[model samples]
Target: MLPALSTLAAPAPALSTANTGFVLICSALVMLMTPALAFFYGGMVRVKSTLNMLMMSFISIGIVTVLWVLYGFSIAFGTDFGSVVGWSGEYVGLSGIGLTELWDGYTIPVYVFAVFQLMFAVITPALISGALADRVKFTAWALFVALWATVVYFPVAHWVWGAGGWLFEMGVIDFAGGTAVHVNAGAAALGVIWVIGRRIGFGKDPMRPHSLPLVMLGAGLLWFGWFGFNAGSWLGNDDGVGAVMFVNTQVATAAAMLAWLAYEKIRHGAFTTLGAASGAVAGLVAITPAGGSCSPLGALAIGAIAGVLCAMAVGLKYRFGYDDSLDVVGVHLVGGVAGSLLVGFFATGGVQSEARGLFYGGGLEQLGKQAIGVFSVLAYSLVVSALLALVLDRTMGMRVDEEVEISGIDQDEHAETAYDFSGAGGGAGSRRAVPAPDGLPATPGGPASAGRPAPDSTGTDNATGTAPHPKVDA
Candidate 1:
């Protein structure tokens, strides 16, 4: 009884207010990424499906936050079970933690850690929405998010980031979710799309982004928030590791953007705004895992390589007849793979861990470990996500009726349109007449005619303009 009483009196770990504040800010930034992603994906889709695209991402915030509090935090960061999953009765509903209790060795409160991780869980599933835009039933998608988070996301997170998990135990360095978040989400995207099939007019129609400005805005916000996403994974700035990661993140993103533009100019004969935005995202994805271990130079290489690779990969969907509506497979999955593997070749051996890449005399050992981590997560996520999607499709019906898809998913699913052009003309789809200058008559489908249809929303080459080919548009 005395020993028990003494143990009960043991002091809790101290918390750092500075680190706490930093993590809270970082959490906000990551939370913003979900909505930012919505805009990015929203603008890339047709005007009719825009609201649906936004809702698909926004709903994850609601769904995942609830789940994380209930059991997700535990299943991910709880006591490891067989190095596959995790559990803790205390973590159920987040009721057992004290306000002052710190997260294991970290200086921040466990609550802060939990919430930060919760943001990660929220955005991961949101990333898959872009792949299935314009066809899936909203109810089916919501249900899929809940199940996938439980069965796919929670377990994979444990395997990669949890203490005593197999991948973590095996010395695979993910640093900031190259494998856990991006690869996990990307592979899941592929799996679910395979089950659900393609959009009705995938190849034949002029599927272009409705608002390049919105895409740019979202891309800018993502860039802003990603600083917190990458640097905050270090959990604190007490060490210089977070600082190094910050620098690497910027360098890699710039390099990737340039590399993508260069590839576009060389291959397609035009550098496009879409390419710029997609290139930046590719860089961000590539640097997610490798940034902590790499120097600025190494990050530049990783970003550039990923940019070109992902740009090339986006065209494969057309060749193979898989309609990845928004290039989730090309950018996230391929970029995630590029970033995770490049860590093996580019790790500096000084930051994050003692492990070195082949260039630093670390031999092929680290690269091999990275490959194991990369493909294992990819395989698990791809297979399990497909099964979950299949189950949902068979039971609840994953897709909306063909009529709803052709008409537009926004009105069917959400009963709202992103843009109301009614004030401009007769109705949302009607074109307004532009007043002709002086005595000049407005030419049909001409620049002066408001009745002229807008250029293909994605900035693709169309009747009115010559832009980049739609095949490479994200």
Candidate 2:
């Protein structure tokens, strides 16, 4: 019966070749953002923890893709069961859906649209990984991703994008996913970090990024891929809205980068590469929801505001004492809120739909709707994510031991190292000196020394019983 139905379910309107091609390309671009995120995050952690950082982002690609195909899509976009969520099992395993079936209004095949959304689901939880870096166990982290996606992400996606979603029906404007993706992930990140506590050297140690170049590379990739992210939300190529989104994306990102650099110069007296990269990301997050509704100038304002605000927000971790390792809460959550709300003030009715904002004389109705969307998602994500982390912490242990953390998670947890310095030509590979016990003089060949050679039959040094110079070369 399902097979027969599938055969007869061909879309009524012929597929728009241009729209299908555009969506397919956009899906590919969005897929690249996850690996780009890995590099961005990998470079921000210490050398010993770099591989784990990359793994956190890369693992999401595998985990979420499978879930989306199995049941996640159904829960997010299936027949709407209520305002809170879509019906479960409606599209399980994509069962009974034909290859040629088109989504309600989209011109692309249903699977192509599903794949586009799959990229979003993959990256949303990965954003949380940045907050819980270094200390989380791989197994526990994997379990968290699976559970959090089902409990937090899918339902939220439904609330914002599903056919009968409350937020959607309330007339909220989310061009992409400021509420459902960034704010949701950011709130969840804060929740988990609160439960996990701080890193071992949160306040004392000089914990710094190992590679800024890698971070810059990741930022560039994110900027590039986001064009597809924002413009592709249109899901068709017939309209000029896609071009407007693309241009607004570029201008907003550039403006935000400048704004962040200016803020850093005033606050710290120097513009840093990391700040530039972070600012670009802040801009991207800010413009996401507002791109379709806002003009280019509005995008600039949104980006600049987000850049400055996120720059300041990152410092909140230090003041409040939460160990958000990579500032996910600062940039995503804060930036998401800024974008989602600013649209209510900046939206114009010329290029896209005719819903005007307050600045355009639409009053405060849209702003109120935006606030509802933002806070609702934030509240839900925070409570549920914190609960998930606590449960995992109790049952499977969410964090690594102190010894493993101090020794470097890459080596202790993965049994591998990110960098090897064995042949760096330190002291010409000579045996280092070792000091004697108590007040005794230091010797060249002793058990305690880092590079000491084996001693002769006598416990003392083979060449000289007398103590050599006490100095030990590095």
Candidate 3:
């Protein structure tokens, strides 16, 4: 056996079935977050704009998937191009990957890693849609998703996670995507809203969420899917890091929710369901970047701080005069910054990497690195996203007509409505009077009412006779 030198050479690495399966499942969970986002944003807008808000998130799935298969993957994870971007002909269309080819040093196949990362790319641009609800045209929004993913998301992703990227090479830690996903999307949201201007009846109108239940459902699902999002970034469970990330994610979220509710009680008068849901999401966002690096207690601190900060930040739209329709900037941008920066103080230096945070005796060096990652991504996304919005506004007109803005965007944009009172009269179709038992008067005081008094233009059910709920300050 020793006679032949070829026989002694090391063989290729074999795939780890366990790691591959784990990553694949995580990919599916992350994919579910997109539709969940649709539900979250859909419930926050007025009845007229519900479907449009949903479509904004739904359309990103289609646009980003196609782009990822073509060149998005390459631009994000391909061979590095001078630290600014990545490029590799083999990664284009994923044609060069093989069945057994593992992802560099990892045991899972390259295809598995590519698809898992794809889910992250899909949801990034969708996060921006919450700010532009009820205003932007469907076609224009779709085009913006494609362009933004190409220009902003892909490049920023490379800078954070891709091999040889500047931020990655510089040792700025981001276990998941606090800086890359949340901050990037939040800054972009601010930029787009600035260009498109405020929603109709911005300050004067009492705009309220049409459905809080839907918002809660979406938040719940996002919490579930995020386990996969945060844990899967480690690529495998061979080490205990993924398990630690999972635990930190849960602890931080719970702490953040409690902290937010406490703030709401003191500042606002009562603890609203909307506040609870928003607080939970704030915790999730804050934990995303620092979860892997911090201990459970550290995660709790980060989550609590982010929760209070975001709760206060949401009111800034009114003070500063920017229409962030759904508090994307408050919860995501502020939460992300809070989480990314906190890593400098909370990182244990024993979990994901050896780098210690300030509390762990590493001093300000790591904190400075984190700051560099945060501001660079924020400044770049804000400037580039605004420029893209400006170009789109000039070319095809970003906003719907003013008349359409007043009358429900769902009907005009998608030709469908979220609900129909046409049949409120008690039949499947036809709102005409039912003849009222041999044509006698159906109602005591009036001839058979027309479909139980359809909702007025203000979207309040006429039958209830109660004024619409006052808009929450959030």
Model 2 / residue 400 / CA error / Å: 0.4
Taking the tens digit of each residue's C-alpha lDDT, what string does model 3 give over 343-385? 9999999999998999999999999999999999999999999
lDDT of 3: 0.87
Local distance difference test, each candidate: 0.87, 0.84, 0.87
Off by over 4 Å in 3: 1-13, 424-474
Question: How far off is residue 204 in model 2, in Å?
Answer: 1.0
State the TM-score for model 2. Answer: 0.87
The deviation in Å at residue 52 for candidate 1 is: 0.3
Worst 10 residues of 3 by lDDT: 460-469
* Reference-based TM-score, model 1: 0.90
Q: Please give the ranking of all candidate structures by TM-score, highest first, separated by commas.
A: 3, 1, 2
Candidate 1 C-alpha lDDT tens digits along 98-207: 98888998899899999999999999999999889889999999999999999999999999999989999999989888999999999999999899998886776777
In model 3, which residue pairs have backbone atoms overlapping below 3 Å? none
